[model samples]
Target: MTLKSIHIEDTDLQIEVKEVRKVSKIRYALKKLIYVPDADLKPKIITKILTHIRNIIENKVKEREEKDHEIGIFIAYKGKFIKGMVIAEDNPHYSSRNRRAASFGWLYAKDYEVCKELMEACESFARKRGKKLLRGPINFPKSVGGYGLQVEGFDEQLIYGVAFNDPKTAPSLKEFLEDLNYKQDSEYLSMEVTQDRWKSGTQLDKDIKIRYLTFEELNNRKDEILDILRGAFYSVLPDAFGMERYKEIMDLLRNIPSHYYKLPKKIKLENDSVQTEFVEAWKKCYDREVITFFHLAFDKNTDNLVGIITCLPDLYELWKDNPITRVNVDVAAVRKGYGRKGIFSSLNNIGQLTGNMLGITYYEGTSIWNLNEDAIRTILPHGRINRRFYVFQKRIKNPT
Candidate 1:
């Protein structure tokens, strides 16, 4: 890209546009560094992911061209064209799952001021692009670019597609844009698995029978297992419950090597409205057994499923080679009024017992804002700490 113009004033700086393909080269380089040798990301796979990014940019460019709008990203500091962003039009469908994610690209900057200038340039370009809203630090949603801004925490390594920036970056960016009439848009929170405040309990072992579904039993009860999952987490993570999305998740889950461990085969819901597509999908994505480890709490008088704990093992490997196996407690629920009745306590005891049998010395459970801490405390006898992730936003209109 070629430089467009630069006007430096006493306090404010005016940046000109530029023509440079540095963004492409940077993305290509990052991919090469992170490629796992035996991983599924072969040449074709790499190309496809890159193609997705290209298509988004091309689509935005086409829209600007046809609409007679000016859509161009400017380099705030030409010395290094390090950051990039995709200008979007608007979000027509804003539901949690079907949100119309327009701008789905990454934005990086050396400092807060430079990022601010670039944001302005993008906004100016957006006006010509016929856009009515502005937001990011994200290229897309978490499923895509790991959406939002970094506010609370800055000193942490970012996940594959997640975004991170200096602590001052979000506040500075927010203030700058606010002064320019940008309104506060939204707030998001990122949490972590901590080990500070939790108090361990043995109730799980005392109350519930916890066991890995023996290879044979799991195979025969696939449908029932998924039903339990559907019933267990449908209320918490609603997105994963959608028929189509659930199928995708299930396909991913089925691919786990643990499926061969007599893990349950996913059962298809008999109702026409409830399809069995998630079964195959689970096989594609998950690398471990279906319902790697599960717990069922029962009343001494009645043998009914009252409380359950479902763990996903993909994250468990993060602590591979170490004695402790960090498992993401994907689903842990107890019927209302039963929470304090030692259901979770029993589940936790069973999980730890099963972990011990499998040679796993430790366990890690991920958490976020507004999650029930008491139940978690019942499981984690040890204390917990706080870890922060980015929560960013931009404005759709100038503030009053």
Candidate 2:
């Protein structure tokens, strides 16, 4: 009950919304862990898995580390029962409203009333930091919750890094947000692609060399490669996949903290993973040994990096103790002048061929935004939409 408070909502019922800032004070917080695969969800994750998910989020929220600053709020009914919960946090990588905003995600509510209370509570949390707008359902940037509420394509297979509602018993968060007047901020798509056969790995063009970059090459050419990336992505539409996250990663990729090198083993990104910092995110799937899948296209004559595609193994499979065979194609882009040429296709084809050679059987083309016509046209053709993601925004009233 450290920072508890009672408030009233604008609805007809005039219910009392009690806030609990400390997770320990509310033992009923874990009740929201129930799970049932709904109209769209498949292969329901049991309550233990949900408990694991809650632990990772709860620990990070409590730690309040550097750019990962976060707060978990529980909307209590009559000061006891847990009606709903939401997480408010600062995302330094977020590119919207000139980056002067916060995110509200890791959401849950039994009904619209609790959802409304949670959303407004997040709004108040935003304004206190001098922000006038808030956006999300981002959930957190890994499996379970990738970047938005699913609005379409529910019958398809679930992929890594895309957000999905854990418990189906509650009203859809998408509907609740719409009822709250939260407008669409961005739209994204995830597609399932497969390469049953290998393709020609021959250099597509005499001037364009497509090859997998080993860790040595990446470590050596990171500065030159990142410069090209910065140029290609800097002007990309904000809130889209071409987010400012790349710009923020310059230092993160360049300077690996001491802890990263000391990890007991290659950290599998899951509920037990404690690697929360941007550096530890190991988000960049650096090709090592047979894991060589990150493909880069370069100008043979100019010897300048021209295009790139990045990917990572689906870490969730580790939970089932199965060989990790699926991959998430997280990023793919060609420079401004490099478009329309076969550079992108060449790089991607080479990526697929090499991925299959390394025992990878499935691929999820993720984070392709609808607003980025170039991305949609290029990526959607590979496979049908597996899931649709959207970001929502609502204006926050200034704090008095």
Name the TM-score of candidate 2. 0.71
- The 0-to-1 C-alpha lDDT of every candidate, in the order given, reads 0.41, 0.58
What is the C-alpha lDDT profile of model 2 across 1-400, one tens digit per residue? 2223445554333444555544454334534432323423323233323443355455533433333444445454534445666667655445463465677766777677667877877777787766677888766543445667766766554555556655353237778898999988788888887443223222355567654444566767766765565444333554532233433233223332222222234544343312132122223334233124456777878878888877665545544455667878877767777765577666666566455545668888877777777777666666767777788998877646
- lDDT score, residue 103, model 1? 38
Which residue segments of model 2 deviate by more than 4 Å? Answer: 1-31, 34-72, 166-171, 194-203, 216-235, 240-291
Candidate 1: where are CA atoms >4 Å away?
Answer: 1-26, 29-80, 86-107, 117-256, 259-290, 293-324, 335-338, 370-382, 393-395, 398-400
The lDDT leader among the candidates is 2
Q: Write the per-residue lDDT of candidate 1 for residues 58-136, one digit (tens) a residue.
A: 5543433223322233433434333333333233222222332223234544444555555666665445445555544
* lDDT score at residue 351, model 1, on the 0-100 scale: 56
Error of model 1, residue 243, in angstroms = 6.7
